[model samples]
Target: MIILLVLTVISIIASLYASFIYAPTELVMGDIQRIFYFHMGTVWVATVAFTTVFIASIMFLKSGKRKWDILALSSAEIGVLFITLTIITGSIWAKPIWGTWWTWDPQLTTTFILWILYIVYLILRSVAGDNVKQARFAAVFSIIAFIDLPLVYISARLKRGISPVVFGPGGGGIESKMLITMLITFLACTLLFIILLKQRILYEKIKDNLRLLKSRAI
Candidate 1:
């Protein structure tokens, strides 16, 4: 864990340098385009986090294990954090380019929905507490929420929207330097996610232990 933390810190510093110093300013959007690297990184991490939640939720359902539930909850919490960052960074980048803080573009709409769904999942988990039946319900909801993940990815391609499709037809490819920077940012974000998830899970376990001790004392 100590080594992981050290590596994550180093990766984050390198990513910042790569984004701000190594990557060239875009001819079109100028320095504002620099936010793109961080934006993509957050998006990538959120995608992984939520996918982890989905899988963990499924595992909990099949195995009926509290650890899996803890994993799902921890991942969901971090997933929400990263998606929140994604939205904020996206809005920051969108303001100058789109002439507004936000728009009801397809990708944005789906992304918003995706965010809301996980928010609801987190709420459900909190309300359920340690109840097995309620936890199962939350798990099932998470599985259903995975459906929106794909919708968020495809919305810009299938519908007329303002979000840029960067990886497919009708998309503009990234420059090599910018691509490298983006990849480094992704590495930083992923490492940060792993660290956060580990801490969160440990915290949850400690909390449970405290609760158990209090009950026994009572």
Candidate 2:
């Protein structure tokens, strides 16, 4: 908990300073482009959370550890928070740049679908009733749902008439300073995610322990 708190504080300070001081003001978008730091940051965190959940689910299935189950749940819950923020921030940025609050663009559509899919996963967990059933069902669904992420990323690039390029590649048209700011934002958000995940897992552990103790007392 102390580590999480410390990291959270550091992340906020670093992210804000990097965005204001290190990042260059965009000429075309002006100060409004400042939102890019948050927009990209949230999305980066969401993506990492989703990936972690997917991998952790697989590990849970293989190892059958209750701790992995807790991790999976924590990650999914945090992923939802970040993804929701990503969609909202992206919409805000889009309204100014794209002139619409939303577009049926492949990227947006895929992200929206992924968000809904995870929401359903959460609902399934609520209805499953028992730990065994919930873990099995959610783990399976997480793996299947994450399969769409790559497709979503690929479709976005294909739709834009740009072949998929690995990170840090040339010809992407992103300026070096913008890229650096994005990297900084990504790092900050990643740290924030670790903090949030730890707190959530600790909370879940406490809640579960309380429930078990209550059952025993009864």
Which candidate ranks first by lDDT, i.e. highest? 1
Q: What lDDT tens digits, residue by residue, belong to model 1 across residues 87-131? A: 999999989987888899889999999999999999999999989
lDDT of 2 at 69: 77
Model 2 poorest 10 in a row by lDDT? 161-170
TM-score of each: 0.97, 0.90
Per-model CA lDDT versus the true structure: 0.94, 0.79
Q: Quick one: best TM-score, which candidate?
A: 1
Residue pairs with backbone overlap in model 2: none
Q: lDDT tens digits, residues 1-218, model 2? A: 68767877877787788788877888877777778788879878888888988988899899888788778878998888998998888788777776778877776778889999888877776676456867688889988999877766766666752122334333346667777777778877888888889888999889889989999999
